[model samples]
Target: MKKIFVVALGIMLCTGISNLQAQNDNSETPNFSKLDASPMDLALYRNQENEPMARIIYSRPQKREREVFGKLVPYGEVWRTGANEATELTLYEDMKVAGETVPKGTYTLYTIPEEKEWTVILNKKTHTWGAYEYASEEDFVRINVPVRKAPNNIEALSMAFEQVEDGANLLIGWDDRYIKVPFKESM
Candidate 1:
């Protein structure tokens, strides 16, 4: 009985060590940001409102001297919009994005890059790791926005919400091109 107990103890220790080694081998540091768009635009611009109406969470990836638009990201292909996990957009209230009504909720953001235009898609699926699981049939809204010329190169993928006359503009930029998706607050 004592021999069997000793063998079991040794096995447990070996398994624990193996687990520790595996963890160490895969140890990685990922910087994530809970980008609050509500305070940036909704709170500051809309004086009558006290709550944040929209937000996004995503990881930033830098361009290390590589071709971005047509090559690295590949034009005409769906991009996850950021690094690591899929970029998420959270809306606290209903809004009209490029004439399509988007109900208030969390959504996975995706984009298809083109030379002169871009397709922005809002999917019902949330917490997706990447665009690998993206399905066109599941798209809530596929809005085509014109690509604008940026003055300077943007090293990282970024989205900025700016106040517009009727509502707000979600500007996505990377490298030297950008696109603005206008949205109006509803409900």
Candidate 2:
């Protein structure tokens, strides 16, 4: 009886240790910098009652001679948009931008940069490296937005949330160019 009890106790201890180890290994990497950057709020169906969601914001580097489109960024590639993971666009609620409605879900954000304009894509996949293996089939929505020259050069790809009368402006800027797309909550 004594031996059986001791063995059971040992087994329990081993199981507990294994569980703890697994948890440690599976823990997600901390995103401390995200807290400091301004966030782009997304509220879907404002008339309805639902919890608002938020995402940490980041932009690609806008270094000169870095090669963008057919070079650094590559014409057709799956760009992650940042250093760690793909560019992350947090959705607070289901919202509409550029005349398209996007559901309340985190998406791997990408853009096909061109001289005249850009085709921004919001894909269902989140974690990826550069846009090397981009698949259009994975895209949830694609919007064509015009780009404008910035008075001042932007050293990094930048995104900001600006308040408007009815909604907010999701702005993306890089180098000497900037683009703003309006995002409004759908009723």
Candidate 3:
């Protein structure tokens, strides 16, 4: 009778341990490659009739938390706007930002963040990793924009469009900071 009780207790412990291991393995990070890739489109400006004036299509990587905004990202420095591959910003039509007119083209996007403002960059180079290899000679346009505090914190960086009377605000928000790039449609 004693031997049978001991065997049953051992079997129950082994089963419980196996079940816990299965739960941990199931919560592991998902393989993004196996998932279908969906790129998002962000419209920048609006016409007099409330139509989209310019659009930017981009794909964000799955991983986060590396040296963003301090070490890997570096404080008071330029970032390549995204991870893994270069962050691509496509201009479907001419638009104006900070008094500069940008023609329709695909450009690599970068940013320099301060506590109160951010400098948005449009570089001629389109494909690269982080800004570790960035060159000022490749810059096509640079514009300074004010940063606004977000009511709710965003874990990941996100961009969206907000309608205005004469144009649209291309808003980029992340980590409690928000920046609005005012884009006016070209007449």
What tens digits encode model 2's per-residue C-alpha lDDT throughout 65-158? Answer: 5655457665444455544446767676777877788887888778777767777888887666656556789898888778788899776667
Assess candidate 2 and give its TM-score to the true structure. 0.63
Could you list the CA RMSD of all candidates, in the order they appear?
10.3, 11.1, 7.0
Where does model 2 exceed 4 Å of error? Answer: 1-56, 59-71, 75-78
| lDDT leader | 1
What would the TM-score be for candidate 1 when compared with the true structure? 0.73
How many Å off is the CA of 117 in candidate 1?
0.5
Q: Give the candidates in order of lDDT, highest first.
A: 1, 3, 2
TM-scores, each model vs. reference: 0.73, 0.63, 0.68
Summarize candidate 3's per-residue lDDT along 1-187 as a digit string, tens digits: 9999999999999999988877668467453455423233354555666565766545443224443445544558887665556667776677776777888888787888877778888888877776776788998888888878789866666777787766677787766667887876656
lDDT of 2: 0.66
lDDT of 1 at 16: 100
Best-to-worst order by TM-score is: 1, 3, 2
Per-candidate clashes, comma-separated: 0, 11, 2
Model 1's lDDT to the true fold?
0.79
Q: What are the runs in model 1 whose C-alpha is more than 4 Å off?
A: 1-50
Instruction: List residue ranges in candidate 3 displaced over 4 A.
Output: 1-32, 35-52, 59-68
